[model samples]
Target: MFRMIPPGLAEAARLTRQGRLKEATALLQGSLAGTRPKPTPARPATRGRIFEVDPATGDATPPGRAGFFSRAQGRPRPAPPLAMPEGARFLRGGFGAAQGERAWRLYIPASLPAGPVPLLVMLHGCTQTPEDFAAGTRMNALAEAEPRLVLYPEQSGTANAQRCWNWFQPGDQRRDQGEPALIAGMVRQVMRDHAVDPRRVHVAGLSAGGAAAAIMGESYPELFAAVGVHSGLACGAAQNLPSALAAMRQGGGTSTVLATARPTIVFHADQDRTVHPVNGDQVMARAGAAGLRAEVERGQVPGGHAFTRTRHSDTAGRVMLEQWLVHGGGHAWSGGDAAGSYTDPLGPDASRAMLDFFRRHG
Candidate 1:
């Protein structure tokens, strides 16, 4: 018999290669409604399972069902409201734009430093709220102690049933558009409302939030002095659901959007399951700084896990990229509190380390 293949799959591949990811996704969704046509590839198609939860990218559907946010795997579900600390206020507000709007929580310390203080933007992972993320990361406490501004931009359940940042969407991955634009708007609003040092603004996130942080840093390198990604993928890791799944399971394709390099620090557990650790490697490579030299160091937290830290410096001798591989760590934030969710207290204090890194870079 003559070799035959699924015509739609070939067309979808072409569409993907052309960077028409939504068209490709729609084609596959429509094609899968029918039986799989016999394949004619000389190389047999690999048999494996793609994650079902990814389509939550659109239609807000969760895995094994036609809706979003049934639950997140392997984490206690708690969306606790943040507690106010002495002499500090956690205020809520929203930033609106033509494309969309994002509600955010700002942490104002009891007393501000004499000069305009740095602004740190924190994006929470999927299924997490600003309050839950603030509690889990203990970021607000740190901001109060150091007396800086901390902003937490929220992802709406209406946009993502799991309340994810939608990092995989092609539109959301670019500058001056989509989710990045909305987040940047919130940051600017905070800057205008407070005494924020323009050059000292920074951004970071955990997991899905981390991935979104990468996009923000890449999209607005001049805006964010440094970038921190905890257990996250690089910018342009995926354009849609299928590509996002592949990028999460493995390292992603070459960066689709990159320009001047910014100071970046990344953290990923060696044993992370939800997002493969190899993705951290990709984030470092995405820096694309010149004549980079990498130095490795290993250290163990007093009562916590051991980690390997690699610093990549350009010829100018400025360490521009740092990667921390937490041994035996999982998908949770390293050295995080358990009060909220998806936190492991046994790793290095990622929040403090990120702040330190931001200080040096900014």
Candidate 2:
């Protein structure tokens, strides 16, 4: 069969011609077919000291208790990556709002450029701490390279037994109320402390955190330029426990439609059993109902997972929403590190792709 030169090799060849052989060689190694990237050696569970946080009381907790885990019959908990990137300052703090105070962790890259920088507020899934989530997603490493700021807001176990953001709760779903207000307060604190470009602020999360991010985008669109939700539901998809469960299983639980839905990028696994894949469709449905035109693309990454991506645009072809359905995958962050919980390393990298998408809107 005739084949086209892969984009990676094409770029590598260009770099080689430009005398950037080292960069070109690195790209070629990553692009090599049939070879999986070597998994980062698993670090000891005790190494996650930075994430062992009690959101409600702002105290230290055990790392293993950070999230939901389903071992393969007798499999052990996944190991975490090495520590936060060198020179990246990880600070634990609290954000006080009218509703209440929330615990948070901020990742300040050592190489932050002068002037205002982009901020990505990351929400953690049920039973997850900011450290654990960041470890699994390996987003902090990406931030080190981009030299961007990253904020992680912890969901209190006092609020939910699972430590999940209350995305289904009406109080948390609206602006200036419950968790939304508290998270927005955290964002404001970071912005005030550092030179954060308000126009470039973005939010993203996994599962419960992902759903909560969708709610945040809906509740405070002005604060976030874009939103990325991985294995999550759209905002207004549920009201209470029963509805939330139903929506998780059966999907289709849109409660409201905003005049203008914020720019969104959603990633879901077709084989996900924790959250139905149809929820991804509902996210697109809600965005489409809000007047964005939908364009779909289906392809597979060589020697990796296949995906169906749909980009929703406006009349002028401005993208408003991008939905990714990872085929043969489970409920996890696409292209995430093995050290963190609920991550699939074989899929497309959600962290890198989300950052790229956020750049276009702001």
Candidate 3:
């Protein structure tokens, strides 16, 4: 029987079968970018059986006829809310003339009773969707709690099969080029539609998305209050594949040409396989040399999570820096939901740290 395979993967397999393993691996990795496995249902363990409870009294009873557990005795069932969280609306239509571009996802806090709230533009990693990022990072929940608007700009697979931001590509790395401009345009649209504080707009991302954030921060410093990079490198750190790989491994790079003096930045890295932790060091050093008074603080968190903060206070006395380095972690989001894609919740909660950092700076 003939087996069905994605064209991209089929090509990769053909290449590998022809003794082109390196080419095949690259193709496969790129194709798998930002992609995640479908979520599986959580099955209850058979070792321990769950019993039903009486609604009137706090007492357990034998399993019901359906053999399923119900509410405990005397406990009232929590009614579902009349409405979903405020500022959590899905826009299905496209934003501009960009064809095949779907509408951007926006998460606004209902508690923004005060006019003009802060906005955070969040970019997802390769092969990731806005919904996946929001679900994995739980940033929307934090937005609801803090009442800040979160913008998730998605990169379609059609743009790049890997679903990456193309930050490493020279053509797309410029100030007014490709996805960078698209992202900036999205920010402007959000600002115009909602009462967002112009001075408090910020940008952040993970991995490739983080690299894109660095590019945005370098090219468009005036448009953002701060930038956050998690498990990513500095912008323009490497000009080519060899240098890129070296920087990815050993870190250190040329200084950024950001016009501002030490813009607010938050850096997170994990000391483990895949991306190197030294990348964080390179980011801090580059930011510091750009005339920002960077204060460095290093520490570790639970579950072998460690971090270094390179803070620079702005004229408004707002504090920002890199944070949340997990010592023994892999290429994954820290403090994220375990059920979400490519995340390890064992470390310090990065979402909380990021929100707090954004709030403090913005």
Candidate 4:
């Protein structure tokens, strides 16, 4: 029998088979930094059932389909528009660049403490806008409550038809390059304009955005003190679309070496068909591969969802990784507002959990 493997994955698998765990991990993780290949019109071959719904009738298209959207089985219910949070100034702006321009939305608290406050950079998932993500995550409420500054960098449709962060693309996965540079630049801009504590800046995202957040932590550990990845893959999980599709269908190939890794917290639903639950495990595996101790616990969210949480700590017992797997949950934000899209109101509040975890690290 003959089978073809993606170059990056094949190399990683080979290293793992030879028992060179450390080298294998580094190769898999660093694969994201590989150069971008020339654009080809051919779509990546996909395995597994397509998760989508016919928008016109709101019915599940039979077994195999062309598009992707892990929408609720039927026509999706209309989500209400997100209301602006009180005591926060919702401002829109643009970031200039050599590559192109990007639109950004910032939420600044009306009142500030005597000293510099924390900053949280949030990246939205596919088919979502800043307004929609803000509404769905209800992150604005948390920002106002914490008196923190928040930045939402939107992915233009020009970059991707689904408005997804190019996490699978090599150029977009490294520090000071492609999308990562743009996002880091946005953080710098916010820091300059506000009383943001440089040491307290953190980044978090959902799905593709989550994967990008992981890359941010990997590439700019100096800039970001902590990271939150919700239903996302580990950094360097895939280098291109085909590899990405394969990674999503099964799991990412192997692991790689990283210069540094910031404290990370992950949230995922065990039943997440869109990205797969094992990716959550990979996120933790990659984080702990550098000799961190891991402790696992299982519990259920009150009247909401059941979950397994794994905490990784350093030799000194400082927590480095917090991975949460929501049992019986789907591909949506846990404990999110119904006002936004792709949210599950029943799980433990990821927004709060991440905030608490981030504060400790910052």
Model number with the top lDDT: 1
TM-score, per-candidate, Cα-based? 0.80, 0.78, 0.70, 0.80
lDDT by residue for model 1 (157-211), tens = 6666467788988889899898999999999999998889999999999989999
Regions of candidate 3 where Cα sits further than 4 Å from its true position: 1-87, 97-103, 240-243, 256-260, 289-320
How many clashing residue pairs appear in each of the predictions shown? Answer: 2, 3, 16, 7
* CA displacement after TM-score superposition, residue 20 of candidate 1 (Å): 25
When summed lDDT is taken over every stretch of 10 residues in candidate 2, the lowest stretch is 47-56
lDDT by residue for model 3 (272-348), tens: 34357777666656655344445667766754566555566555655545444566666667777743454667666
Cα lDDT tens digits for candidate 2, 160-251: 64577888778989999999999999999989999988899999998889898988887787899988888889888877654565567578
lDDT of each: 0.77, 0.74, 0.61, 0.75
Q: Comparing 1 and 3 by lDDT, which wins?
A: 1
From the highest TM-score down, the ranking of the candidates is: 1, 4, 2, 3
Error of 2 at 291 (Å): 4.2
Please, what are the lDDT tens digits per residue for candidate 4 over residues 308-344?
A: 8888788889888898989988878888986777789
Off by over 4 Å in 1: 1-77, 255-260
